[model samples]
Target: MAHPATDDARLPRSGSALDVAEYFAPQRTSSEDLPEIEPLVKNLTIGVLEVLAGVREVDQLARWLGEDAYRALVTRSNLSARARSARGVAAVRPAHRILTQRLCEPTDGVVEAVVVVAGPARTRAVAMRFEGWDGRWRANSLALL
Candidate 1:
């Protein structure tokens, strides 16, 4: 008798396993399928600045950020907090206004944006790249200049 463990019918076809795994993985949605990108980008810019300024907790924005972006924000926030502690500065809401926002879509589900913000101290730009993931936008990369 043939061994049941070695039965070909019990195993998935060569490439079907990969297909099955991918089917269960988080799906990538196109920008056309997602909500407006401008609003999300603007919100994230302000959120990131607030977190760095010690006025907001990084966890508050975790839902919209990818793993790497979230970790980077946490690290930057920690550094900011340490600096504030050394200077004996208390956390205060940063006064800033969004000046200009420019967005570009290089591919179907990706958006790159730069937002200029005018703060009481100086004007700065926040750059971010967003990807449509699982039917929503997620920030995978962020930088404040």
Candidate 2:
């Protein structure tokens, strides 16, 4: 009995175009080199989260935001008629353990999220935002939904 050659010639060349390298070329993609999922949320959340991971003071939270919104977000705890909402939640003197999430529109790179702040409450749903810098994906505004 003979075994199949199992080489490039044995396989369909067009389908195997990405076979140039063993590790990197696994598939031949027609789409752009980007993820299928929307990046609307994940990108911002990830950046803020990464910065927060290194944070030792309240001021650091303001740094993740755009210039105009920073002042509003840092002024004090005030979001709605709801008393002392997650407003300045990160600035609470002591941080809370809670879930943080980013809902995505990957292609647009905009997102919404529920950021876990303090005890019991656990999360805040941030929604309806855009992500872009010169038409490229960036978290333009992060809001609590």
User: What TM-score goes with each of the models?
Assistant: 0.87, 0.36
Candidate 1 whole-model C-alpha lDDT, 0 to 1:
0.93
Q: After superposition, how far is residue 14 of candidate 2 from its true place, in Å?
A: 42
Tens digits of per-residue lDDT for model 2, 3-69 = 5675545666653445555435323322233343244344444434333333332255453355544
Off by over 4 Å in 2: 1-59, 77-92, 118-130, 134-139
The stretch of ten residues in a row with the least summed lDDT in candidate 1 is 11-20
Give the per-residue lDDT of model 1 (tens digit) for 1-145.
7788999888767677788899889899988899998888888899999999999999999999999999999999999999999999999999889999999999999999999999999999998899999999999998889
Runs in model 1 deviating more than 4 A are: 1-17
- For candidate 2, what is the TM-score? 0.36
- Candidate 1 global Cα RMSD: 2.9
